[model samples]
Target: MTVGRVGKEILEEADFNKFRQALIEELVRKISRGGCYGADIRQIIEETLREEEFVNFANKLAKIIEKRTNISKESSNEAACQLVEEEIADDIKGILHGQLEERKGKSKKEKEIDFMGRESKLWDETTKRFIGKKHGLKDIALILKEHRLMKITIVTGFILLIISAFLFNSIYKAIVVGLTLTIFSGDSLRIKLANVLGGLGGILIFFTSISILLQYALLEERRSMELKEMARDYLEKAKRKENFN
Candidate 1:
């Protein structure tokens, strides 16, 4: 079988860790054999590149290529074989580099001056934008606006509360009698059953209101925590950028 086919077979298992382990094994073999494993290694990388549609794995593959080539250079070889192996290693490295460059979307720079002063413009935009005293309030407002579920739940709870009030008001006597039937003292079985049902309905409505209020409280807490997390992330990024400068 061709080296590419061999690589395809190795990668057929489709586990990244497995592929990495197998690549390491191949690298060790290549080092021991003074770069005889060059084609097989290159083909393995090619297969990986083909399998991964996105370029997320490009950087990792680049690192692997670096280690593989470094080991190939250190391996012992006869004078004639050393020259041939070195050439093969160089070719492999060059191909890998080219593949990486293509994936990165880099191209030759255009011959143009900074006539628009874009760098200065960007600096001004970044520096001039102030986080005001009310920025925290503004961020909270933004979060509330963005959260549809929280708003919907609160509104639904309010509507249900209103409905419960209307229901209770319409049948107040029934609900009251249902609670204290012994006090009324002239109750038939059918009347008692109706009163009991009316009271249960009122109780269910009140419980539903309580449930909704609890839900709102939980959602509010979650949103507050989320805001803190966002602030922390922003601060971290700013700190890193400051350190980098």
Candidate 2:
């Protein structure tokens, strides 16, 4: 979608309007309170803008834009940031500058320098939080647990264990290992050793199956992460290309 189209949609969003108004009102209240230095005022403004509700609104906007335009989330997020900077930040900076002027009556040169510095800082923080933030990767274990291949591997492994138990007659050995070592107390040393080795071999087969499955799961998860990063990078490049055009 064109930048103007996205901007128009952002302007029409009710939540965006509410967020913008609330931000301005909060900033005005905080700035009007006496005794805040310029830095303190900037900090207050930045902290307020970064509040959970405001950040959530930005995220929500980005998701909506992504869904509507079929744009990459990163590009949609940039669009969201642009909307916020244009619709909310300019008004905030204007109010702040006016407040500073009233409070200090500073020379124009001094006021201009301070204003530029604060503006730079605010934008830097906003850009970092809004556009540069990343979503956390899905939990590999949880994801793999529900994976079709992983489930098959687990069931197959269990079946192999049962088959091994029957083939090697290691069920008693397994019971001995699981419940009590004293099950074969009256047996000869050779018998005990044979049972132990047979049981261990069966267990090893099951564990080897599990290990292979885990390795496959990890590789799949890593590949998924790489694909996501590549997509984000592609989107970022596309955004840059769009801007250049």
Candidate 3:
């Protein structure tokens, strides 16, 4: 199935209205960043029109000119406000300025910036626990024991599992690493570290899985037995596990 997008709906026309909408979109971006409300955007648009067109019109042009599909009326206001702020026409006199749709999708650098915000939102959305949803002690304990129910320990345990996978050369270890990271992406580290760790943990899981499976397959039974015996031979190395980074 193809994913649908907005903003492109206005592309049917290649006129002044289109330029206004494009200008509005840029304005919207700036206003959004500053947390400016629609009123602020409208005020800016009004000032721009009054100065350039020699008229003080409200510029309700977005709502009037286009159907509000992906664009909100408030968003239109923001977009118009943003248009004037960026110096599109420099003077907005008789000269015409046209802004094309940059792309159907956000540029990769824009997407990267957007991704960090989304990743932040993911953390922010997880902040509070719902008390009523909390079950009894027995239920909680049983939930903790299940492989599928790793909502909490996965954070630190994921890192540990990564380290553990290298030591064991087992697919089980890699699966455990992935499962742990997924369960606790919202948690696990300071918010900043959590973002880095969450992404890294995902990468670690995939590569570690392949590394583990191949390492296991390559080792013959006799070699495996010898490795285990050799591991057991050293007391100091007993507790510390090797890393798979």
Top lDDT prediction, candidate number: 2
* C-alpha-based local distance difference test score of model 2: 0.48
Deviation of model 1 at 85, angstroms = 68
Deviation in Å, model 1, residue 82 alpha carbon: 76
Q: lDDT tens digits, residues 1-245, model 1? A: 11223222222323334344334333333322332211233333334344444134433433333232332222211111212222233333332222111111211221011111122121111111111112335544444466666545545544443443344454455545433432223357544445455545445545544655565556545544443344344445555887999
Give the Cα-based TM-score of candidate 3 against the true structure.
0.19
Off by over 4 Å in 3: 1-55, 58-82, 88-159, 177-245
| 75-140 per-residue lDDT for model 3 (tens digits) | 444333332332232222111121111122444543443333233221111111110122235443
> TM-scores across all candidates?
0.29, 0.30, 0.19
* Candidate 2, backbone clash total: 0
What order do candidates take by lDDT, descending?
Answer: 2, 3, 1
RMSD of 3: 25.7
Question: Best to worst by TM-score, what's the order?
Answer: 2, 1, 3
Candidate 3: worst 10 consecutive residues by lDDT? 122-131
Any residue pairs clashing in model 1, and if so which? Answer: none
Over the full model, what C-alpha lDDT does candidate 1 score relative to the true structure?
0.34
